[model samples]
Target: MRGGEAATLEAVLQSVEDPEIPVVSVVELGIVRGLDAGQVTITPTYTGCPATAVIEANIREALDQAGFEDIQIKTVLSPAWSTDDITDAGRQKLKAYGIAPPPKGAKAASLCNKSVAECPHCGSINTREISRFGSTPCKALWQCNSCHEPFDRFKCH
Candidate 1:
Protein backbone atom coordinates (compact mmCIF):
# COMPACT_ATOMS: atom_id res chain seq x y z
CA MET A 1 0.00 0.00 0.00
CA ARG A 2 1.05 3.58 -0.51
CA GLY A 3 2.08 5.82 2.36
CA GLY A 4 -1.13 7.83 2.30
CA GLU A 5 -3.21 4.64 2.18
CA ALA A 6 -1.61 3.28 5.32
CA ALA A 7 -2.25 6.57 7.06
CA THR A 8 -5.87 6.31 5.99
CA LEU A 9 -6.15 2.91 7.66
CA GLU A 10 -4.64 4.34 10.82
CA ALA A 11 -7.16 7.13 10.81
CA VAL A 12 -9.95 4.64 10.33
CA LEU A 13 -8.74 2.50 13.21
CA GLN A 14 -8.82 5.52 15.48
CA SER A 15 -12.51 5.91 14.73
CA VAL A 16 -13.50 2.37 15.72
CA GLU A 17 -15.01 2.69 19.17
CA ASP A 18 -15.52 -0.09 21.63
CA PRO A 19 -19.16 -1.01 21.23
CA GLU A 20 -19.65 -1.75 24.90
CA ILE A 21 -17.76 1.27 26.20
CA PRO A 22 -18.68 4.11 23.91
CA VAL A 23 -16.09 6.47 25.32
CA VAL A 24 -12.93 4.49 24.59
CA SER A 25 -11.63 3.62 21.16
CA VAL A 26 -10.48 0.08 20.56
CA VAL A 27 -7.06 1.37 19.50
CA GLU A 28 -6.55 3.36 22.70
CA LEU A 29 -7.85 0.43 24.70
CA GLY A 30 -4.95 -1.63 23.30
CA ILE A 31 -7.26 -4.06 21.59
CA VAL A 32 -5.92 -3.61 18.09
CA ARG A 33 -2.71 -5.43 18.80
CA GLY A 34 -1.21 -4.88 15.36
CA LEU A 35 -1.91 -3.88 11.81
CA ASP A 36 -0.11 -5.18 8.72
CA ALA A 37 -0.74 -6.00 5.10
CA GLY A 38 -4.35 -4.95 5.23
CA GLN A 39 -4.80 -7.16 8.26
CA VAL A 40 -5.57 -6.10 11.82
CA THR A 41 -5.16 -8.51 14.70
CA ILE A 42 -6.92 -7.73 17.97
CA THR A 43 -7.42 -9.36 21.31
CA PRO A 44 -10.66 -8.75 23.12
CA THR A 45 -10.37 -7.03 26.47
CA TYR A 46 -12.46 -9.84 27.87
CA THR A 47 -13.14 -13.26 26.43
CA GLY A 48 -16.68 -14.13 25.39
CA CYS A 49 -17.34 -10.42 25.51
CA PRO A 50 -20.77 -9.49 24.12
CA ALA A 51 -19.30 -6.63 22.11
CA THR A 52 -16.85 -8.76 20.15
CA ALA A 53 -19.01 -8.93 17.07
CA VAL A 54 -19.76 -5.23 17.01
CA ILE A 55 -16.10 -4.37 17.53
CA GLU A 56 -15.09 -6.60 14.62
CA ALA A 57 -17.75 -5.05 12.44
CA ASN A 58 -16.51 -1.63 13.29
CA ILE A 59 -12.96 -2.61 12.42
CA ARG A 60 -14.02 -4.14 9.12
CA GLU A 61 -16.09 -1.10 8.23
CA ALA A 62 -13.24 1.20 9.04
CA LEU A 63 -10.77 -0.77 6.98
CA ASP A 64 -13.10 -1.07 4.06
CA GLN A 65 -13.76 2.64 4.11
CA ALA A 66 -10.03 3.17 4.07
CA GLY A 67 -9.77 1.11 0.84
CA PHE A 68 -8.47 -2.04 2.42
CA GLU A 69 -10.64 -4.63 0.69
CA ASP A 70 -8.58 -7.63 1.73
CA ILE A 71 -8.67 -6.90 5.40
CA GLN A 72 -8.12 -9.77 7.79
CA ILE A 73 -9.21 -9.52 11.41
CA LYS A 74 -7.82 -12.04 13.85
CA THR A 75 -8.43 -12.55 17.57
CA VAL A 76 -5.57 -13.68 19.77
CA LEU A 77 -6.38 -15.08 23.20
CA SER A 78 -3.05 -16.17 24.58
CA PRO A 79 -1.29 -13.69 26.91
CA ALA A 80 -4.79 -12.36 27.49
CA TRP A 81 -5.68 -8.67 27.93
CA SER A 82 -5.06 -6.43 30.90
CA THR A 83 -6.31 -3.02 31.91
CA ASP A 84 -2.72 -1.92 32.26
CA ASP A 85 -2.35 -2.03 28.51
CA ILE A 86 -4.92 0.70 28.05
CA THR A 87 -3.41 4.05 27.06
CA ASP A 88 -3.26 6.88 29.56
CA ALA A 89 -5.32 9.02 27.19
CA GLY A 90 -7.97 6.34 27.05
CA ARG A 91 -8.12 6.21 30.85
CA GLN A 92 -8.48 9.95 31.06
CA LYS A 93 -11.20 9.88 28.41
CA LEU A 94 -13.06 7.29 30.40
CA LYS A 95 -12.91 9.39 33.54
CA ALA A 96 -14.09 12.50 31.72
CA TYR A 97 -16.90 10.50 30.17
CA GLY A 98 -18.15 9.75 33.73
CA ILE A 99 -17.05 6.12 33.77
CA ALA A 100 -14.29 5.01 36.09
CA PRO A 101 -11.39 3.26 34.40
CA PRO A 102 -9.95 0.12 35.89
CA PRO A 103 -7.10 0.73 38.25
CA LYS A 104 -3.65 -0.64 37.54
CA GLY A 105 -3.75 -4.32 38.50
CA ALA A 106 -6.47 -3.52 41.02
CA LYS A 107 -9.00 -5.91 39.53
CA ALA A 108 -6.66 -8.86 39.71
CA ALA A 109 -5.73 -8.10 43.30
CA SER A 110 -9.31 -7.29 44.16
CA LEU A 111 -10.08 -10.98 44.58
CA CYS A 112 -7.62 -11.02 47.48
CA ASN A 113 -9.60 -8.35 49.45
CA LYS A 114 -7.77 -5.31 48.13
CA SER A 115 -10.87 -3.85 46.60
CA VAL A 116 -10.18 -0.87 44.32
CA ALA A 117 -13.72 0.17 43.65
CA GLU A 118 -13.46 3.90 44.17
CA CYS A 119 -16.46 6.11 43.55
CA PRO A 120 -16.07 7.87 40.23
CA HIS A 121 -18.53 10.53 41.22
CA CYS A 122 -16.99 11.42 44.57
CA GLY A 123 -13.46 10.02 44.20
CA SER A 124 -14.11 8.37 47.55
CA ILE A 125 -13.53 4.80 48.55
CA ASN A 126 -16.87 4.84 50.34
CA THR A 127 -18.80 3.02 47.68
CA ARG A 128 -20.91 -0.07 47.32
CA GLU A 129 -21.43 -2.40 44.45
CA ILE A 130 -25.01 -2.87 43.38
CA SER A 131 -24.36 -5.45 40.68
CA ARG A 132 -21.54 -6.94 38.68
CA PHE A 133 -23.29 -6.16 35.43
CA GLY A 134 -23.44 -2.54 34.41
CA SER A 135 -24.81 -0.86 31.27
CA THR A 136 -22.18 -2.84 29.37
CA PRO A 137 -20.73 -6.30 29.77
CA CYS A 138 -17.31 -4.87 30.53
CA LYS A 139 -18.35 -2.79 33.56
CA ALA A 140 -19.75 -3.37 37.02
CA LEU A 141 -22.59 -1.40 38.54
CA TRP A 142 -21.74 0.70 41.58
CA GLN A 143 -23.22 3.47 43.67
CA CYS A 144 -21.39 6.23 45.51
CA ASN A 145 -22.39 7.26 49.03
CA SER A 146 -20.93 10.73 48.74
CA CYS A 147 -22.59 11.70 45.47
CA HIS A 148 -25.59 9.45 45.85
CA GLU A 149 -25.25 8.56 42.17
CA PRO A 150 -24.87 5.23 40.44
CA PHE A 151 -22.11 4.72 37.90
CA ASP A 152 -20.38 2.02 35.93
CA ARG A 153 -16.98 0.70 36.94
CA PHE A 154 -14.80 -0.77 34.23
CA LYS A 155 -13.83 -4.22 35.34
CA CYS A 156 -10.17 -5.24 35.44
CA HIS A 157 -9.24 -7.98 33.09
Candidate 2:
Protein backbone atom coordinates (compact mmCIF):
# COMPACT_ATOMS: atom_id res chain seq x y z
CA MET A 1 0.00 0.00 0.00
CA ARG A 2 1.12 3.55 -0.61
CA GLY A 3 1.91 5.78 2.36
CA GLY A 4 -1.33 7.70 1.98
CA GLU A 5 -3.36 4.52 1.61
CA ALA A 6 -1.78 3.06 4.71
CA ALA A 7 -2.52 6.18 6.72
CA THR A 8 -6.11 6.22 5.55
CA LEU A 9 -6.51 2.56 6.37
CA GLU A 10 -5.11 3.14 9.86
CA ALA A 11 -7.47 5.99 10.50
CA VAL A 12 -10.43 3.99 9.22
CA LEU A 13 -9.56 1.00 11.34
CA GLN A 14 -9.07 3.18 14.39
CA SER A 15 -12.55 4.54 13.96
CA VAL A 16 -14.23 1.11 13.87
CA GLU A 17 -16.38 0.90 16.99
CA ASP A 18 -16.61 -2.15 19.22
CA PRO A 19 -19.98 -3.82 18.69
CA GLU A 20 -20.57 -4.40 22.40
CA ILE A 21 -19.36 -1.01 23.51
CA PRO A 22 -20.21 1.65 20.97
CA VAL A 23 -18.48 4.38 22.96
CA VAL A 24 -15.06 2.76 22.41
CA SER A 25 -13.43 1.86 19.13
CA VAL A 26 -11.58 -1.36 18.48
CA VAL A 27 -8.27 0.50 18.57
CA GLU A 28 -9.11 2.17 21.85
CA LEU A 29 -10.05 -1.21 23.31
CA GLY A 30 -6.58 -2.48 22.34
CA ILE A 31 -7.99 -5.05 19.91
CA VAL A 32 -6.27 -3.65 16.84
CA ARG A 33 -2.75 -4.84 17.52
CA GLY A 34 -0.96 -3.58 14.40
CA LEU A 35 -1.52 -2.24 10.93
CA ASP A 36 0.80 -3.09 8.08
CA ALA A 37 0.95 -2.49 4.33
CA GLY A 38 -2.07 -4.73 3.69
CA GLN A 39 -2.72 -6.41 6.98
CA VAL A 40 -4.48 -5.57 10.23
CA THR A 41 -3.76 -7.66 13.30
CA ILE A 42 -6.14 -7.96 16.22
CA THR A 43 -6.34 -9.69 19.59
CA PRO A 44 -9.72 -10.41 21.06
CA THR A 45 -10.33 -9.40 24.68
CA TYR A 46 -11.92 -12.70 25.68
CA THR A 47 -11.15 -16.05 24.18
CA GLY A 48 -14.70 -17.34 23.89
CA CYS A 49 -16.43 -14.01 23.71
CA PRO A 50 -19.33 -14.02 21.26
CA ALA A 51 -18.33 -10.51 20.26
CA THR A 52 -15.02 -11.71 18.87
CA ALA A 53 -16.55 -12.85 15.60
CA VAL A 54 -18.64 -9.69 15.46
CA ILE A 55 -15.56 -7.54 15.89
CA GLU A 56 -13.69 -9.31 13.08
CA ALA A 57 -16.72 -9.11 10.81
CA ASN A 58 -17.17 -5.41 11.49
CA ILE A 59 -13.51 -4.77 10.71
CA ARG A 60 -13.77 -6.77 7.51
CA GLU A 61 -16.83 -4.88 6.39
CA ALA A 62 -15.27 -1.54 7.25
CA LEU A 63 -12.13 -2.34 5.32
CA ASP A 64 -14.10 -3.52 2.32
CA GLN A 65 -16.28 -0.43 2.34
CA ALA A 66 -13.22 1.79 2.59
CA GLY A 67 -11.90 0.32 -0.71
CA PHE A 68 -9.24 -1.74 1.01
CA GLU A 69 -10.64 -5.06 -0.05
CA ASP A 70 -7.17 -6.52 -0.50
CA ILE A 71 -6.27 -5.94 3.13
CA GLN A 72 -6.26 -9.00 5.39
CA ILE A 73 -7.52 -9.22 8.95
CA LYS A 74 -5.34 -11.48 11.07
CA THR A 75 -6.13 -12.69 14.58
CA VAL A 76 -3.14 -12.99 16.88
CA LEU A 77 -3.72 -15.17 19.89
CA SER A 78 -0.26 -15.08 21.36
CA PRO A 79 0.61 -12.54 24.04
CA ALA A 80 -3.02 -12.97 25.07
CA TRP A 81 -4.95 -9.74 25.53
CA SER A 82 -5.21 -8.16 28.96
CA THR A 83 -7.44 -5.44 30.31
CA ASP A 84 -4.30 -3.38 30.87
CA ASP A 85 -4.03 -3.04 27.10
CA ILE A 86 -7.10 -0.79 27.11
CA THR A 87 -5.96 2.78 26.49
CA ASP A 88 -6.42 5.53 29.06
CA ALA A 89 -8.96 7.16 26.79
CA GLY A 90 -10.82 3.86 26.51
CA ARG A 91 -10.94 3.53 30.29
CA GLN A 92 -12.34 7.02 30.56
CA LYS A 93 -14.95 6.24 27.96
CA LEU A 94 -15.95 3.06 29.74
CA LYS A 95 -16.38 4.95 32.99
CA ALA A 96 -18.35 7.65 31.26
CA TYR A 97 -20.61 4.94 29.86
CA GLY A 98 -21.39 3.85 33.41
CA ILE A 99 -19.14 0.83 33.32
CA ALA A 100 -16.23 0.62 35.72
CA PRO A 101 -12.92 0.05 33.95
CA PRO A 102 -10.50 -2.52 35.27
CA PRO A 103 -7.64 -1.39 37.44
CA LYS A 104 -4.19 -1.13 35.94
CA GLY A 105 -1.41 -3.66 36.58
CA ALA A 106 -1.56 -7.08 38.24
CA LYS A 107 -4.95 -7.68 36.70
CA ALA A 108 -5.21 -11.37 37.39
CA ALA A 109 -3.75 -11.11 40.86
CA SER A 110 -5.79 -8.08 41.76
CA LEU A 111 -9.03 -9.74 40.74
CA CYS A 112 -8.06 -12.81 42.69
CA ASN A 113 -7.46 -10.59 45.71
CA LYS A 114 -10.91 -9.08 45.37
CA SER A 115 -9.73 -5.51 44.99
CA VAL A 116 -12.42 -2.94 45.64
CA ALA A 117 -13.80 -1.37 42.50
CA GLU A 118 -14.94 2.22 42.57
CA CYS A 119 -18.57 2.82 41.79
CA PRO A 120 -18.97 4.29 38.34
CA HIS A 121 -22.01 6.28 39.42
CA CYS A 122 -21.01 7.55 42.84
CA GLY A 123 -17.25 6.96 42.87
CA SER A 124 -17.61 5.02 46.05
CA ILE A 125 -15.26 2.25 47.09
CA ASN A 126 -18.06 0.76 49.12
CA THR A 127 -19.41 -1.54 46.48
CA ARG A 128 -20.31 -5.20 46.31
CA GLU A 129 -20.32 -7.71 43.53
CA ILE A 130 -23.87 -8.77 42.80
CA SER A 131 -22.88 -11.36 40.28
CA ARG A 132 -19.70 -12.81 38.89
CA PHE A 133 -21.12 -12.18 35.47
CA GLY A 134 -22.73 -9.06 34.16
CA SER A 135 -24.69 -8.19 31.05
CA THR A 136 -21.63 -9.37 29.16
CA PRO A 137 -19.23 -12.18 29.83
CA CYS A 138 -16.37 -9.72 30.21
CA LYS A 139 -18.02 -7.79 33.00
CA ALA A 140 -19.31 -8.36 36.51
CA LEU A 141 -22.42 -6.93 38.10
CA TRP A 142 -21.77 -4.56 41.00
CA GLN A 143 -23.85 -2.31 43.19
CA CYS A 144 -22.76 0.88 44.89
CA ASN A 145 -23.84 1.15 48.51
CA SER A 146 -23.57 4.92 48.56
CA CYS A 147 -25.80 5.63 45.60
CA HIS A 148 -27.60 2.31 45.56
CA GLU A 149 -27.01 2.13 41.87
CA PRO A 150 -26.18 -1.04 39.99
CA PHE A 151 -23.42 -1.00 37.40
CA ASP A 152 -21.31 -3.27 35.32
CA ARG A 153 -17.60 -3.53 35.90
CA PHE A 154 -15.16 -4.74 33.26
CA LYS A 155 -13.58 -7.82 34.71
CA CYS A 156 -9.81 -7.91 35.07
CA HIS A 157 -8.14 -10.61 33.06
Which consecutive 10 residues in model 1 have the weakest lDDT in total? 106-115
What TM-score number comes out for model 1? 0.86
Best by TM-score: 2
lDDT by residue for model 1 (1-157), tens: 7888777777889898988677889988989888887678899876777788889988988788777869889988866777877889999888878788888765456432225577766788788888877887678888888888888888776
TM-score of each: 0.86, 0.93
- lDDT against the true structure, per candidate, is 0.79, 0.89
In model 2, the Cα lDDT at residue 141 comes to 92
Residue pairs whose backbone atoms clash in candidate 1: none
Locate the minimum summed-lDDT window of 10 residues in model 2. 106-115
